[model samples]
Target: MQKKAGPFFYVFLALFVFFVMFPFLWVLLSSIKPLGELFGDKAFDWFTSHPTLKSYVSVFVNYPFLRYLWNSTVVATVTTVYTVFVAAFAAYAIARLEFKGKTVILGLVLAVSMFPQIATISPIYMFVKKFGLTNSYLGLIIPYTTFALPLSIWLLVTFFRKIPFDLEEAAKMDGATPMQTYFKIIFPLAVPGVFTTSILVFIAAWNEFLFALTINTAEKYKTVPVGIAMFQGQYTIPWGEISAATVIVTIPLVIMVLLFQRRIVSGLTSGSVKE
Candidate 1:
């Protein structure tokens, strides 16, 4: 039997939800408000006296926001696909095959993930510049993949390790080749983990700011974050427009998480205990 939550539990949960959601609520409010009301004395009011979609419309009309969205979509989608594909193979090898220096390799992957992006940015920028990839999709995609791989690999290794070795043995007994066994039997069973990793990597790539800003300086290649950050004026900042753009950028991620949340939860928990 399970115990029911008391008043204190409900209070704490409500408070925690509010604490996590207040920033988004504030941004949403700001997006709907007119510039004067957004910046003026009634800025913190819970409801705006006059809510308008002018800011949202201006985002599309005055700027190349659609192009930025498209750029972000392409970069993030490609990065997630490439990172998960490579991580899948690397993780399968690490989890199933016996190899020397396996521990060292895993440790190195963790170390690379923990390495400060700021510390490595200069060299990455130089490398991209040397390859003449700057101001291009590949420029951002490469760095995003580098940062995204370690976590994806780690999560996938956990999932792959949880798959029964007997399955592989059975496939081999049936005269299936190694590639056939992996693609047919092992990979399908690990789909939940793969989906989870792809979502995380995609979100990271979409929201990445520093590498996008540094590597893709041209207006045509700028992503959502870089484009949003570049929103400015000679006399004042366009807070309403900025907020509107932020809301627009965040909606897709929210919808994705909501739709696939069950898979994400199951994927994360499935590998926690050995069968």
Candidate 2:
């Protein structure tokens, strides 16, 4: 039998929800506010006197927001796909096959993930510059993949270790090649881990600001976060426009997370559980 919830639990939960949601609500409110009220003394007003879509309109008219969205989408998608693809094989190798220095390799992958991005910025910039990849899709994609791969590999390796050994043996007895067994048996069973890793990688690449800012000097190649930061006026900052742009870019992420939230929860929990 389960105990009934008390009023205190509901009260605490409400407070926690409000605490977490206030910033998003504030930003949402700011996006629709009239520019005058947004910047004026009424800036902190909980509710707006006048709400309009003018700021949203201004964003598209004044900036190439769509191009920024496109650049982010392409870079993030490519990064997630490439990182997951490479990490899948690497993880499989680490989890299933016997090899030398396997523990050392796993430790190294984790170390790379823990290494600060700030520390690598200068060297990465120099390397990318030497290859003339600055202000290009490949420039960001490569670094994004590098940062995302380690974590993805670690997650997949841990998840793969949870899978049954008999699955592999069964496929082998059916005259399946090693590659066939992996693709047909192991790979299909690992979709949850793959999806979870892809979500994390995609979000990290999509919201990555420092790398995007450093690698792309041209406005045309700027991602959404960088582009939103660069939106300004000679005299005063356009808060409404910035908020509107932020809301625009943030909506897709929110929707994506909402739709796949169940899968994400299940994937993460499944990976964490031990047999």
Full-model lDDT for every candidate: 0.88, 0.88
- The weakest ten consecutive residues by lDDT in model 2 span 263-272
- Candidate 2 on 68-110: residue-level lDDT in tens? 9999999999999998999999999999999899999999998
- Pairs clashing within candidate 1: none
Poorest 10 consecutive residues by lDDT, candidate 1 = 266-275
Q: Which pairs clash in model 2?
A: none
Give candidate 2's whole-model lDDT. 0.88
TM-score of 2: 0.92
* Candidate 1 Cα misplacement greater than 4 A, ranges: 233-235, 263-275
Best candidate according to TM-score: 2
